[model samples]
Target: MSSGSIFRFSVMAAMLLAWPALADTHTPEEVPQTFAEGFIQGVGVPVISVYHLAAMIGIGILVGIAARGVVPVLAFGAAAMLGVAYQLSPYDLPADDAFVALTTMIIGLLILLRKPISPRVASGIFAVAGLVHGYSLGAVVANAGAVPVLAYVTGLLIVQTAIGVAACAITLGATKWPARRTVLLLAGGLVIVAGGLAAIEAAGLIG
Candidate 1:
């Protein structure tokens, strides 16, 4: 089957699993207000949150699948940092988990395609994903005070940078594998599944 076919099937499967009437529900985890005194729960919680971690991992893999460089990852990191700055500013965006989930879907689809896209185009996509993710991180610490907020933003960037680089390396290395394409297709499908679960949870239909 082609990449497009795989993506379409993944979407359909996700939609079926996310069916409002048939899905099982679970409570979203309570984000702690603080993490060890002065350590910055505002930043720490989001960093360790399963949802955020999953998103980061998915994004990293997508970047790797598309190309074999760190530019895209850096692009995402730069935009995300800007997003963190925006969060600290006098502006706020609605805390919507669905938005994040949708972005995850986009990244998964990109990975599913497994196409070699232009560096500029890939960088742009990663940048957009980064911005949204950064904003999400910022929301968690919006009320954690200046010090914790700073630490949180810094931590997010650091963690993402590490994850992104590692993901790129792994994908690049997979190129030598005889079954690289098949493995990537499976990874893309899994990412889609993760995104679907996230969307369902965000919609409050399940956890």
Candidate 2:
């Protein structure tokens, strides 16, 4: 065979072999599983699932664009808080953890309305939110045991960091008033609506 053909054949064989290994490394688990299992089963918990992850990443990019005047450190602090909130809180379809979800929405809206808060302030807010996020993971760990818990939390952290980085990049690139204002307005509206829904749920108005 020609060199090109041989190279193609080798590449195909490698991919074929790699496929099974990847599958073995990431098999799905049975139901009644912990939050982490659910997260890992979907391949990460950054925002509960792929759809949520995409939504949050989009939100982060918008927030970054709106907050362009801020430095990377500050922008990242805000983004990280949002990321943790999106990931750990049970805001998925079934909507578990209404309290955390409500709190996150309130905080997100506050950030959207107010000018870029100090990095110190953002950091403190994120620290408190992070504990709630961590506790959500701990709940999973307590119920599901170690391995699944680790996998779930690891996936969440990896996705959270990536989204935070993307948000910072968006903020760095924003330079126009119209785009920034639009993002802030839209994000603010979303937070308010989501917060309202969460509040209702927390008050026992929703299932």
Candidate 3:
């Protein structure tokens, strides 16, 4: 098989392994506030676990690569899937963490709509996003049982993958429109602005 086909199969295998772990780890309960409670309570259900988090990082990389080929619809589909996966997860994050995730998602989407960024750059941003996401995962892991922790991480990976895939489609579509190039530039600018904002927040420069 071709390299592309091999890669696709690998991704599929990863997803298949990740999904069962998610289902196995889930518990029926309302979302928890603290990470400890979340793990024990299995509050996030379908999305919590270390495996899921790794999957998300992988998804982001895949999306970055995919953006070079697919259309915007594909990107949208990916984002939608990520969102759905997040909603399904048993891990609940603190409000601030949720805000960060939302901001990152927006940033990812904007990046997709604009010009095609270098994969390295996209991956760097993804790494930062992953840090925040991982912290949230850690919190749940600390408080919950091993099973819940596993499930939560799994959820994160699935969602991240979806987001990355969506970004790929958007970036690919943007390349075809001359007029859209301006929008793409603006989107990039927004990413810079968002990054600045995130930095400020991290430094405790803003509330």
Candidate 4:
């Protein structure tokens, strides 16, 4: 079947999943019970989450400053799938929170400096961040049915790719400006602060 067909079927499945819930008078918003709902939730959830938003901004900067191809972006998406798969499994990844904080901070540092790392290293950073973030994202749909999960993944990739590409484009364009370095430094500093706060919160040093 074509990808479009598969997506249509997925949506149909989600609607079927919703029928019983609807008949029972359950609140759809209480959980993702439709493909459209799941996809929207997936797209908006990451952007709305403060820590993830900051980290994503840092990621976009890293991508933009590198001025490389989409390999890093693709790597992130692929690795994110692995993370979500793991979350769907019976196991829990150890030290995930610490590792996420570290990655977030490192990406911020790189962006703050406005220095492009090697493509290989940059892709690795993207993968690590994607894995951790995806694992966390999976929690939202952990108990969801197959169709909603599929829709969520689809929307997650679409939105994230858009964000990464948009940021990279802007950064690339900004490179010609005289104060490009200063602008990059300011953005990176913000990411660093966001990452640091995430780390402190994870460590329970503060609420």
- Candidate with top lDDT is 4
lDDT of each: 0.62, 0.45, 0.43, 0.69
Q: What alpha-carbon RMSD in Å does predicted model 4 have with respect to the real structure? A: 11.9
Per-model TM-score, in order, reads: 0.73, 0.56, 0.43, 0.81
| TM-score of model 3 (CA atoms) | 0.43
After TM-score superposition, the amount by which residue 168's alpha carbon in candidate 4 deviates from its true location, in angstroms, is 0.5
How far is each candidate from the true structure, as Cα RMSD in Å? 7.5, 12.7, 12.7, 11.9
**Would you list the rank order by lDDT, best first?**
4, 1, 2, 3
What lDDT is obtained when candidate 4 is compared to the true structure? 0.69
Q: Which ten residues in a row have the lowest lDDT in candidate 3?
A: 69-78
Give me the displacement of residue 179 in model 3, in angstroms. 2.8
Please report the TM-score between candidate 2 and the true structure: 0.56
Candidate 3 structure quality by residue, lDDT tens digits, 1-207? 344444453443344345433433213444445445443433343244322332343333335434543233233323433443344457544463444435444553544453355555555554545544444444434444545555555544445445446444443444444444444444344343444444455456654
Shift of residue 74 alpha carbon in model 2, Å: 11
Candidate 2 on 67-152: residue-level lDDT in tens?
Answer: 54333333333443444344444653233345446545655566466465555565555455444444433443344544555465
* Per-residue C-alpha lDDT of model 4 across residues 1-207, encoded as one tens digit per residue: 344433433332233234222322111235578899789877877666545655665676678788887778777777777787788899998876666677777877887677777779988889988999778777778888888888888888877777666666666666656556766676666566666766776787855
Q: Give the Å shift of residue 80 in candidate 3.
A: 19
Q: Rank order by TM-score, top first?
A: 4, 1, 2, 3
Off by over 4 Å in 3: 1-133
Top candidate (TM-score): 4
The residue-level lDDT of candidate 2 at 155 comes to 62
